[model samples]
Target: MYAVFKRELMGLLNSLMAYITIGVFLLATGLLLWFFPDTSILEYGYAELTGFFSLAPFLFMFLIPAITMRSFAEERREGTYVLLAIRPVTDWQIILAKYFACLVLVVFALIPTLIYYYTIYQLGLPQGNIDGGAVTGSYIGLLLLGSAFVAVGIFTSSLSKNQVVAFALSVFICFIAYSGFDAVSQLFVLSYFETVFLSLSVNEHYQSISRGVLDTRDLIYFITFVALFLIATKAVTGGRKW
Candidate 1:
């Protein structure tokens, strides 16, 4: 597992696409946080990074799929997946290795955003008057959210040998997972099940944690969400002739 993990991580780092993906993510977030008049922190007149935290998940919907689209799709298309499947390691290890590699890349994209936090911290009227707890919680929520998206991406990648197909499917699923439930809950016909639908949405739990209060239920939901997709990927791989 460690060998596969290391290899996968290095492979991502060595790929130009990986760097481009991360670069684009950073560039987009930087523009939205500082340059864009609408979402800019300067326009908000607040030390809080609420705008950033609110916009990141939507960015992630596209970013994570781009990172994970080739995880299995490219391998399968290039006839490398068979070699990977027949390795000594368990299927779970391969899935997890690929998942973590993609997730680490997502983290690389996120780390630079800390500069936004620091800038806001300094920009505070009292200098460092920003809500540190909420920032910490939002970062944590973003990490969990990214992890779930990686799982979703890996699963979608396993379903197709075409990278574009994998990317599109992953993005669609990520969008639905993040907010589709909330949209469903808004329906008058679903009003009786509104609580159930909202609880299933990633935004509901994420919003809870972004408030600086961590709940075990949200943690468990994310864990289950990740596990389900990974297990689904394992099923897909295991059934293949490889």
Candidate 2:
């Protein structure tokens, strides 16, 4: 597992697309949080990073998929997937190793956003009056949310041999999981089920924990979401591989 993890992570780091994906993520976030006049920090007139958190999810919708689209898709494309299946590693180990590689890249992309946090912390009237709890909570929430995205991406990647299809499918599926429940909650016909629907959505659970209060339910929800996809990927591949 560690060997697969190292190889997967190194492969991404060595690729030009990986750098471009991370670059675009950082650039987009930088523009929105600091340079762009509309949602810029200057316009918010506050020492909070709410806007940054708000925009990150949308950015991740594509950036993460781009990173993970090639995980299994490329292997199948190059006719190496069968060889991978016969390796000494368990299917879960392979899936998890690739998943963690993408997660690390997503985390790498997010690390630069700390500059936004520092800037807000220093720009406060009291020069560090920022809510440390909320900042920490938001970052943690983002990491978990990103991890979920990586899992979704890997699942989609495992489903197809075409990287483009993998990317598109991953993006659509991730978006639905992230926001579909809230949409269902708005339907009056499903009003009775609204609570349950909202509970299943990543956005709602993310907002719950991102508020600086860690809820056990929210943590379980994310972990289960990730585990489900990882297990599903293993099951799907095991069926065909064996």
Candidate 3:
């Protein structure tokens, strides 16, 4: 497992795609947080990172899929998945290795955003008047959201040999998991089950955590969400004779 994990992580870090993904995420978020009038914190005249926290998941929706699309898809397309399957690692290990590798790339993309936090901290009217707790909580929530998305991407990548198909499927599933349920709940016809539908959205739990409250229910939901997709990926991969 350690060997697989190392190999997977190194492979991602070594790839030009990984850097491009990180660069794009940073560049886009930077623009949204500091330049884009509508979402820009500077325009809001507030020392809060609310703009960033709110906009990041949307970026993750596309960024994570790009990172994970080739995890299994390329391997299978290139006839290397069979070679990998014969390795000493178990199916779960392989899935997790790829998942974590993609997640770490996501983390690398997020790390640079701390500069925004620092800027906000310093820009606070009283100097450091920013809501540190809320910022911390938002970062935690974002990480969990990214983890769940990574699992979804990994599962989708396993389902197709073509990277484009995997990428598109992952983005669609990530969008639905994150916001589709909430959108459905808002429909007049679904009013009776609005709570149930909202509960199923990644947005709901993410919002709960973003408020700086460490709710166990929200934490559990994220864990369960990630686990389900990882297990599904394992199942999909296991079905193959390789």
Query: Once superposed on the true structure, which residue ranges of model 3 sit more than 4 Å away at CA?
Result: 188-191
Ranking by lDDT: 1, 3, 2
lDDT of 3 by residue, 156-185 (tens): 999999999999999999999998998899
Model 2 lDDT per residue over 1-242, tens place: 99999999999999999999999999898888888889999887989999999999989999999999999999988988788778899888888889999999988898888988888888999999799998899999999999999999999898999999999998998899988878888884556688878888999988988899999999999999999999888877777785
Clashing residue pairs in candidate 2 (N, C-alpha, C atoms within 3 angstroms): none
The worst-scoring run of ten residues by lDDT in candidate 2 lies at 184-193
Candidate 3 lDDT at 121 equals 90
TM-score of model 3 vs. true structure: 0.97
Off by over 4 Å in 2: none
TM-score against native, each model: 0.97, 0.97, 0.97
Cα error of candidate 2 at position 205, Å = 0.5
What is the lDDT, from 0 to 100, of the residue 102 in candidate 3? 87
